[model samples]
Target chain A: MKNFSRFTLLSLLFLYLFFGNCIVGNFSSVYAQDDWKQEYSSVCAKTQNAMILTPEELKSYIDRCDKLLALINELEGEQAATEKKVYTKRVKMCRELYQFALEYKEHK
Target chain B: MAPIQKLLSAFIIALTVPVSASAADYSHYLRHIPPAENFGQVVLDNYSHKAGVLPVTFDHWLHRAKFTCRLCHIDIGFAMKAEMTEISAADNMSGYYCGACHDGKRVFDGRNIFGSCAENYTEDEGKRCARCHSSAEAEERKYDYKSFSEKLPKLPGNLIDWEKAESEGKVKLTDFLEGVSYKREPLKAQDDFTIKIRSWDVIFSHRKHTVWNGCELCHPMIFPSTKRGTTKYSMFQIMMKGEYCGVCHTSVAFSVWLCAKCHITLVE
Candidate 1:
């Protein structure tokens, strides 16, 4: 009984330290960082640079890229598809870049 | 009461007290955040923490005197946060970001606005770096917010109106880049629409937003690619925190008390 009481006292003390007034809120908890979105934008910029199309020309090129991406996604889902994971990731990147391009236009 | 029961009650009381005290502490922190030196300074801190340094300061107060917020934030493609959009000095020099307005021949700064970049690089042009990197301590603020904003045509009707002066053409913002944004076709703006709120019935207007932020200010980052609801946010979180709307709402744009701006309905 004495040991049980002692263990209970230790556990209560531990709980007080862990979740009590020890940790104060800092900037990180106050803000949410969107790492996923930042990575997406970076990937998009790299994929589109190879073509080097003018602003007007870039739109049509991006549209075609979007169609190609949808086709690739459809192919990947089929029963006998053999596309590599890298290829699938690249297609996803292209579609995201195309959307970013459209967003650029809307902003303009 | 037995010893065990007495201890249990003490623990429960201890837990409740801290939670209540912590909430009060956060509320106090929100009330005490310092005002920034300038709007650009505030924007830079918010932007840099989120992304990185912008190619330039991109002053709203200076630019809005001649142009409207719609001209650049909408038409020119400047994001609200720096580095979110890939802005290069090369792009600006070619009339992309600051180049559209700073072009030496047509648009000049004060009276001598020049092209985005130099035709030739000068060997000793270190002094000119402060033009965009005005965040350095040496730079002096040209306009005082209180005096400058006092005479603004569109003075804010609410607690703090960050965009009121800029919206009324009291500030001139440049949109065309001498080289990058070569195409200068006039834009016929679409009529303002009421973006339906999902969880609440608050209707956000495109017209009011255009006064402070053009389309590019939000776009795919805050809103997203497809027409989907923005991530859920709470008033308590935004007022005392940072995020999409909180970026401005808590800082310069408006005070936290103006709940009607977003949350239209009040629950009794």
Candidate 2:
């Protein structure tokens, strides 16, 4: 009786772990992308205001763009192709503009 | 005229125009200039035909006459290529792009600019919709290109001398929009530099171009490289093909046939 109880407890524990991971993975696929999409929108949204940014601020965004670009590049599957292309170009445009602003602030 | 027709005309000119035997024969690079009425007309039809509405005939001169190029291109996030922006009516109705100005609440020149789009419209509002979605050959236009160009300085091909028009303040350009644009220090003007060509080294004026383009329009996109001598441009690319300076000069800014404008070193 003691052995049966222990065996049942172990099986339940394994089952819980398996189902929990499946639920979490599914949730991540749906919700995880929103975080980056929001981040991208906010990051690139400030292009109109770039000239007003301080050198430090510009540098931070440039760094942020580079980091986002790296993670975005690592995104796999054909579904990610459009996102990868659009995001990569948008990020690069924002990054280059930020870099240009930094240089302008320093030189001019 | 359509972009296709422009290309065909340029090709025909390239074939017919006599190749210059000497440096002075700049006629080799001349292109056919569209008349004033049709010069800068852009048809926005990305979703128009499918939506059962006529394509919006966007007159570049009408808008650019009052607003800076940067206002539309950078701040408004409009793509340079026509129909490339993929502007949907839904986007406009949400107070983005054209809706940024055309919200119908914002007062420009003490008159309310009509709202760009709406989810539903009464019979009266139908007229407002027709303002943009008019037929291609629609004669009823609030701003006629011919009358508008009359006061502005004229170029060889009857194009508006935009540089002169701005310099003289004949047309005052609004560079900043209230909510959409933020206040910032003006760009410290960059020095004019010469772009070397074989027959004539072109003296490119940064100060002149900056007035209309601001900084964002050209930098890192059209002319990506900051380093001098990095980007090589041939007349073949400029006159016959849409690359480098041809991006604007061939279509909007001025004709490359006005060689004396850029190739000023030899002419002077």
Candidate 3:
């Protein structure tokens, strides 16, 4: 009886350990994804107004894009590949846009 | 004395005769214009064939008729060229890309916009799959470009006069999405500028372009330099080689063949 009870406890503990990690992992990933998405959206959203930004401001944006791109590339999971590709392309485009504005400002 | 008089008359005639740019000859620059329905249509086969379905056909005309260029390119982050987006069924079901709008629950034009990808659809629901995957059936499509475009303003060639249609309130373009796009101040368009060449001086309008493109579409991607006269490309480049203005005009816009549209001021 004691052995059977111990087995039940062991099985319950095993299931809890397995699913608990999964649930926690999934929630952490969701928050991580939201963090990067928010960063990406905020960074790329400024591209339309790039022309009006100062050269210093444009340079700063370029730095932000590069950093965000790195974060996107470092991501891993089921949807990581698609998310990485999407965010990488967008962040690079944003970086290029900022660089273009910086060059225009410097020339003037 | 007669010979000199003839020369003077010829010079006078040349000066008086307005340099009439061939308006109807926009087709000269195009290899072949797609039929009105096929215009701006792109079929993406990224993972469709791998997943045992026909390629998805995205008709830009229908989408652009309702949404602004910035909403997709800037807000949603859709790549400009074909197959560059690499969309997947999983991505759509997870609420990215096409899922942003076609979430099945969202209503448009008084009806629910069809969802892009679902978790599990039976074989009987193949009709729903065929909507975007392309069944080659006309009835499956909700919107018909021919009848819809018939009411809109016509350009010189097969293209629709989208600018006129929007300006006259025939079509109201939506520039914002609820969650995807950040709410911000409307763009303040710069004034018009003239690009002087040896032959025709082109009159470029920022206000007109901003209405459709919202600045980022051309800036940095098409035109690296925003300043006046900094970025230079000749007619040889645009018309013959398909560069600069030819990029959009050749494929989607009014086209580079319509010379009078841009080269309004003649240099001679």
Best lDDT among the predictions, by candidate number: 3
Assess chain B of each prediction and give its TM-score: 0.54, 0.86, 0.82
Task: Pick out the ten consecutive residues of candidate 2 chain A with the lowest summed lDDT.
Answer: A78-87
Model 2 agreement with the true structure over A1-108: per-residue lDDT tens digits: 999999999999988899988999889976767766666767766665676889999999899889889878877764465446545755677788888778767866
What is the lDDT of every predicted structure here?
Answer: 0.45, 0.74, 0.74
lDDT of 1 by residue, B36-132 (tens): 3234342333333343333345454445455544345434554555555454455555555555566566645547654455546575554454466
Flag the better candidate by TM-score, 1 or 2: 2
- The TM-score of candidate 2's chain A against the true chain A comes to 0.83
**iRMSD for each candidate structure, in the order shown:** 13.6, 6.0, 2.5
Give the winner by DockQ: 1 or 3: 3
Q: Is candidate 1 or 3 superior in TM-score?
A: 3
Which candidate model has the greater lDDT, 2 or 3? 3
User: What ranking emerges by DockQ with the best candidate at the front?
Assistant: 3, 2, 1
Rank order (by lDDT, best first): 3, 2, 1
Give the per-residue lDDT of model 3 (tens digit) for B25-109: 4544344455667766788999999998889887777787788877787667787777888888887876778988888987766
Ranking by TM-score: 3, 2, 1
Residue B35: error of model 1 in Å?
A: 2.4
